[model samples]
Target: METFSIHPIGYVRERDGSKVLEVLPEYRPALDKLDEWGHVVSVWWFSGSDNPDTRSILRQTRPHQSSPGEAGTFATRSPRRPNPLGLTVAKIDRVDVEQGLVVIDRHDALPDTPLLDIKPYSPGSDRVEAPILPEWAAHWPKSREESAVFDWAKEDGKA
Candidate 1:
């Protein structure tokens, strides 16, 4: 198998209770004009879950109530995969180019999580007009804004 290397360009931070992505001094230049986009796609590492055992978990039962009883790792967004990477599309609240800080509305990453990369969220390519979902998840929210208020715990039968 071919191997690849990945180095974090920055780290996620918590500033005054707000989530922020602080790019390293060397990568700050990449943030140039990023503010023009209203949202960004953050690629981060699942640092805490990266391990031999986790990486070996290829199947999960009841990963989510809306999912099948058992599913392959690729079928669900389990952090325990061949590659422990996480992707999140976050709404940009603010961006400070000089400081290389990006304040986002929310992210499913832990503070200090290693940030792999950031790309402007282009709707033309990122948004799907009609996405096919299993019957179980057909009732889920249709938009990110709606998802913010959606009761995922309830949908997962954990509420």
Candidate 2:
């Protein structure tokens, strides 16, 4: 069978080195041509968190508690789904080759989240006309602190 390898463009500078992850050095140069895309899709690995040890976790999580029926992993945005990959449609806040950084809209990921790869977020292709998201996810309660977490991650590196 043909083989494949996953590479990263750069580490996420979110937590000021507290939660850092290095991208494959070989793919570091690929970022040179990425600046043209204003926003890129960040497909990173959740190196810290994995599928929960419990089998019941596979059942519908929050939706079941609220909706009264267990949902499948694929239907909900549960983290314990198959492959355990985290897909965030993040914006290209900044890119610095010298320091090896790809600053993004930092809220979706945790500090030290492993940098797997980055793809351009193309409005013409990436967007869906009518997204049928689950009922539980239709409304996310955003607070001042929750919304500002990414801002801190994107803060100036020099300052």
In candidate 2, residue 113 scores what lDDT? 65
Candidate 2 lDDT by residue in tens digits, 24-143: 567767677676787777777665556455323566534433343566767755555545677776556666654566666543667666677777878799876666655654443243
What's the TM-score of every candidate structure? 0.95, 0.67
In angstroms, give how far residue 27 of model 1 lies from its true place: 0.2
> lDDT score of model 2?
0.58
Report the error of model 2 at residue 92, Å.
1.3
Candidate 1: C-alpha RMSD to true structure equals: 1.4
- Candidate 2's TM-score reads 0.67
Clashing pairs in 1: none
Cα-based lDDT for every prediction: 0.91, 0.58
Give the Cα-based TM-score of candidate 1 against the true structure: 0.95
